[model samples]
Target: MSRERVSFTELTDVSQKYWPEASVGVSLIAPAIYRLHEYLNRLARELFKQYNLQSAEFETLCALRNSPEPYRITPTELYRKLLVSSGGMTKILLRLEDKELIERPANLADARSRLVALTPKGKSLIEKVTAQLIEQEAELVARIDQPGQLEQHLLRWLAQIESHQDDKGPHL
Candidate 1:
């Protein structure tokens, strides 16, 4: 089977015909951003599926594994860090617990909250998966002629966008 490949030129041509008033900047950058987002998402899903993990499950495990000693943290903290709702986090935690990948132990310091820690199995899984993910990411960008320069440019661009977000003005 074969797939048709759409070029950036075609995209710009279509945009130019459909929306003549739009700036060239938007026509180029917007589609590129969307395509990059889609490609990254698909890659992430494939990587997670290889380990039989959903994105949320992998993120939750990563949160616990990246925490301090014993790699434990509160559910509240996890949800906050992940920008997930309390109810949504609870469901993710429940699934992890059911899989024996995490445990909800009594928080000796605070009776109100429970500590979520990775099981040895979970720790091992995260370590292995994380390494694989990093390797895959590196491979994806390896073809770039100047990755460091690209990274610096992206960082500056993203920072500029973030800094201006609160200005309540038009953005490019």
Candidate 2:
């Protein structure tokens, strides 16, 4: 199926009319970034739904899958890695446990914390879902004429933004 191509002309026009003091690049880049985020999020949500997983749940599984042998990590570590709150991580872990996709066992090192690990079923499901997501992402990026070049540019842009995160004043 064909879709209408996105363009920045309207953004530029509106910026010029209502916010002439701002750089036109701001209008172009911000909306493009937001739209790109929305599009990718929509695709990810669809993929997660197909696998009976929420985005957070999938992320938690991935974190476990990437960990050392036995594929286990502490709840605090998982929350930190996923940039989520402890309470939220606890809820996600509880849901996955109920679904028999994950387990929470008392931590030997820290009695105050618990270790999270994938069940056999969780491992199987994550493997399948991750493979499908990789395929979908490959297909999506393949649409671009120079996917590698696009990736490099995006990475550089992101790095620049991240490097300036600690600055007290706006660097953009």
Candidate 3:
């Protein structure tokens, strides 16, 4: 799983030599974006490993961390927000509770399900991890000049794509 990927240069070279009729720059756009996405995922996995956490576990913590004050949400809410199955969310919640990173308190609104909230330790740890993640991401982008402009371009591109998805109807 530690194999290196083919470079963008190689991809461009193939497009130019084998498919001369196509616009090489335009043709390579999606592949380039996909490669970057893969690299970012790998980077996040490595960072999470350093904290002895699985990516899903970190995501669960983050969902709670980013929630409204009191930092609590029902298991159903967590599963929906994290786009995980209810069973998967249950496993993640159990692991986090075992780690003492979160606590489940009785939900006054409903007796059937408990509210998941960050413990004092969980809150502090998440804040520290979030800061580190920001620092690491900033360092990755610092190599490029005009990073802010690049961000704006990406934001616009994302918005356009999302709008097209809207036209296609609801996501599954």
Q: Order the candidates by TM-score, highest first — what do you get?
A: 3, 1, 2
Poorest 10 consecutive residues by lDDT, candidate 1: 22-31
Q: Score candidate 2 by lDDT.
A: 0.87
lDDT of each: 0.87, 0.87, 0.87
Error of 2 at 87 (Å): 0.8
Candidate 1, residues 1-172: lDDT per residue as tens digits? 8676687688678778998677555536667878877777778899888888899999999999889969998888999989899999999999899889999999999999899999999999989988988888888899879999989998999999878977856664
The residue-by-residue lDDT of candidate 3 on 1-172, one tens digit each, is: 6788678898778878998778634656677788888888888888888887898988898999999989999999899999899999989999999989999999999998799999988898888877888888888899999999989998999888888887787661
Collision count for each candidate, in order: 0, 0, 0
Candidate 2 lDDT over 1-172, as tens digits, reads 9687545677667778999888645546666778777778888899999888999999999999999979999887889999999899989999999999998878899999789999999999999999988898888888889888988998999898888877845665
Measured by TM-score, the strongest candidate is 3
Off by over 4 Å in 3: 1-3, 18-25, 170-172
Which pairs clash in model 3?
none
